[model samples]
Target: MFTREWLRAVVVVMFTLAPMSVGAEVPWQFADNTRYMAMGDSLVAGYGAIPATQGYAYLLYKEGVFDKIPNTLLSNVGLIGATSQDVLDKQVPLAIDPFVPTVITLTVGGNDLASILTGADPATVLGNFQANLTNIFFQLRTALPEAKIYVSNLYDIPEIPMATEIVLLFNGIVEGVASGFQVPVADVFSAFEGRKGLRLIQRNGADQYEVHPSNAGHRAIAKAFKAVIENN
Candidate 1:
């Protein structure tokens, strides 16, 4: 009953089927058939990746990583270069869709801080940024009541020594505002703090770090977001 040839065939079959079995058994938890919205600036726009088009949102959707409890219906409304005010004016409106129980993710405020840092007054600019962010989320809540909102705290971009303090200030405000909204906030600030000032290549191999993250950086952010989404 246990011939050598038969045993060899059995082992091959087992090896062939093992990966599928494991994948099938993995548990996935997130809503299905619901509309998903990605609202942010260049980070969500996926500035640095192979083919340069696979943002975290697209990656998660294509990989079926969050397709167990609820299938992912995604909309990417992130702009390549959008400030908080710009997102308020533009990105928020694009989230209008028919899908119920939608999930919205956003990252913003860096550009605003940059502008303010160059201006004469800092206090007023900081206050205005906070107010604008709060308003943006409020508008999102009003427009997408059936959706679950997720926002990312601004990434730390000051390790370059030129804007370190200003970046920390911006991130502090972002985190505080995100907390007030009671939404899941991905902490990209901490994840990128150590990597600041380091040159990360874009999909095109151009060295850029003033605003965009490398592929390795994006993966780190995506993993953090995945964890938070799972827990929520």
Candidate 2:
């Protein structure tokens, strides 16, 4: 015996309440105190971004991707030229001790692959990278079992010799290692796959084809990370 107007109001209320129910179903939620630690190589250090702050890690902190700035704490241990081994050695110890991050984002292995350019054998480089990455995850998971760890796969630099094939292999390793730890990976590889102006090396008439990401690239990387964090 409901009137038409009452039915319309009820329908509107149901639609409004439905969204809230869906939103509540999201597994992750913002915490009042979130300790976000960023660990990795040059990309995590914000190398190509004019100012290091423009790097994707900083952007995630500044934009409050994990939590509100006032509530969230950030510890960025990302170093330029840091290979996966460096992360396993230097960064991992720090993350375990003083920082004890509640959340972590890692981007590495690009520098490990860079060794192949210096006459290092490709098989050796990939093997070492895989071992190092596996250890990095294993250590982090052991030390910070509850921490939300997110890792990014390397992007492709098609201009470099054999870069595409190498990067594909690197990403495969990343995926496999991260899967073992139940860590989510931001698909930076796909984000920059066919994109232009993302790499500083791609700039017109650049003196050197640096592999670092440009500002636009950083934003894209941040976006990719954000998507994974929000969803998983």
Candidate 3:
């Protein structure tokens, strides 16, 4: 027969080796009535994805980044060609009023930089972008003090001249503004850096190129958002 002390020691070891509960490991819970709003440009609208449903915003909703599908209601107000000013003027109002989002993801400023391609002064474009982005964040934070907001930085396209440099500047602005409002930034720039087959425009053989993420790229962007949300 085993000694009482030996049996007690065995039980202690078994208890010590037991696995932790799944709930304890997870950082977030599936809270009820989570309203998620996505605001930005073409990427938010899923332009590059064939059906658009494959866009990062949709994927985040479908995959339950913020909460479970049953508990999460997603409203994507990301216009196809929306600039920072457009988002401030159009999307923010909707987010504040009827939607009253508990969670928001914004992706703007790319269209603001497009003005540079048309001979608009880079300094002027960047200044407007910075001001508009600052206002966008300020309004959202002020209006929805309890909501969690995440923003994405721009990715680099190697094909265009000085694209990398310009994108870096834009990402800097994104980071600076986001930091001011205590908003987390999804580092899409790093996700696409030196990566092949992320841009839909690159896959097409035509001389003209459009600056949008492919399906795989959307997935990458979703992953970036998910990472920040989970950590935050």
Candidate 4:
């Protein structure tokens, strides 16, 4: 059996590579009092990293044009350890508290896949992934009809040998759902694959299975938002 320590060590190998920018922009134009809401899982919640609000959602809010012009940027609705179904069931309702968010960001589905990986059942993982994608999008569309939603393409976590195929399967569902919904898909998968020395699993100085982005990875994701906003 692969010891817990051993599993984490192998996962660390996949993230050791560095990231390059695709430069995708945010689709919504910046406006006064423009509200932004981020709803998703640990990556959205800033897992393995303290001060979760310091994650990309807050970072992007800080860099946003509305922040400079007296806009109201609602706090990021990050639900730690939330699965996609959780987002459907929990986060979306909370998003409407302050007002309608003009912009939305989400990074979910990892927990669902991770759950399957832990159980060693790829078939079950794939089915849950497809269901989660449908539920996540359905909830997003239903809850925030006018919000420009950004659903991230799952990052490759082959760094954790226990679940690469599962990750790929989950990502496939995510991509197909994104296409169907007209939601902008941020492709973190393309950025992580084959990149050397990126280190996806870093927690403090050690590594683990929970995949959170480093400063560099967050910058790349932010760039994608910038690109989507500017071009679309």
Candidate 5:
């Protein structure tokens, strides 16, 4: 029953069904393709993923989540410890100079509220975050005049103190700013609601967890953005 040809066929099938590699070609890698940039924090950087590409941005492109955008190149500009101000000051010009992105996804502001854990009061934190978000979107609008920007609002984490309040205020600011810029908001908050512990965020020490997405969580994120694209 174990013929050599049968074993060979099984091996071939397994290899064929294997996941695609990171560097694999998509549309033959042309220069004029849509420049897709991911801007914000560690979640956008694929922080917890085993391989960097296993994160949402790369998966979005690889899985053809953006069928609306063809011939694309992904530029990940997510910093590990970036805040909304960090993104405004640092990440803005990165998207502007040399290559103008055609589509952009941003995940910021959460770090601003997360700083509340560092002893900053929520009211002051919210004020500063809103100002930074406004400035960020304004600069992006001024620079890449034609890019389609998608912003993901903050989600609630049970462990983070005052997270629900922060979510309401922060997400409102995010949606408001995105609206001012005429950008669509991706519902990463709702998508991640009850699943943070199961597959989305990373597990930290006892009673503590990193707010970054796990690989499966990244896929869910990519799917959320994909749904936005599909709906629009």
Candidate 6:
């Protein structure tokens, strides 16, 4: 069994391990035309990946999994340790809206519960995260009226059972919110389930369930978003 504060400890470890320069460089393709804006936490930032650019946003842009509409620009402003509130209060207006992004992808709420999923009143944290998330969606719709908004539901962290439970609840909220706004959800949860080391995590062989992604995992995320984009 992991530590009592296992999930929180893992997240902090990941954040600490992430270098300042990890995600700073953008592929030439992204810099030239950033029609897509990725906003969220470490997952979106690709913290645990060997090269931060191996994260999902870059994969969606670079992975030739499915063809994108020509000239689609993708940019990721996802920050390590960012919570849903951070996205609402800080990252959104400053980074997202001004870009006039044609497509916006969000993956948030997990960090809001960090150590608190085991707390006495976890519902309170979930509620607050939901409110902040709803506001983010509403604001985005208002600011980028014509933009397509896609939300990535929480995916399970295999070593932590409580985290999976949290993923269920958090993803439910994501589904409900997306439904209300008539937005599409990229079910990154299902995509990551059952194949942690192989499909999702960075490690191969016996141990892949820890956290973060391998290059192939990032490509999977890219495909999930691509599916949403194509269907919607």
Give the lDDT of residue 201 in candidate 3: 66
Measured with C-alpha atoms, the lDDT of residue 72 in candidate 2 is 60
Q: Clashing residue pairs, candidate 3?
A: none
Model with the higher lDDT, candidate 2 or 4: 2
Sort all candidates by lDDT, best to worst.
2, 3, 5, 6, 1, 4
lDDT of 2 by residue, 66-165 (tens): 8866556576778888988888888888778765779999999888888888889998999999999889989998888989999999889999888999
Q: Candidates' lDDT values, in order?
A: 0.63, 0.82, 0.82, 0.62, 0.72, 0.69
lDDT of 6 by residue, 11-110 (tens): 3343343345435533332334446667898879886666887788767656533334244544466888798988887667754434567678888776
lDDT per residue, candidate 4, 66-95, as tens digits? 344234344455667787777776666565
Question: Which 10-residue window in model 2 sums to the lowest lDDT?
Answer: 10-19
Question: Candidate 5 — which pairs collide?
Answer: none
User: For candidate 1, lDDT tens digit of each residue in 120-164?
Assistant: 466777788898889987877777766778777756554344566
**How do the candidates rank by TM-score, highest first?**
3, 2, 5, 6, 4, 1
Q: Candidate 3: worst 10 consecutive residues by lDDT?
A: 22-31
Query: Best lDDT goes to which candidate?
Result: 2
> Tens digits of per-residue lDDT for model 5 on 62-117?
67565323445556677788899888877787778644678888888767877788
- The true-versus-predicted C-alpha distance at residue 74 of model 1, in Å, is 1.7
In angstroms, the error of model 2 at 34 is: 0.6
Give me the overall lDDT of model 1: 0.63
Query: After superposition, which runs of candidate 5 have C-alpha atoms over 4 Å from their true positions?
Result: 1-31, 67-70, 196-209
Residue 174's lDDT within candidate 1 is 75
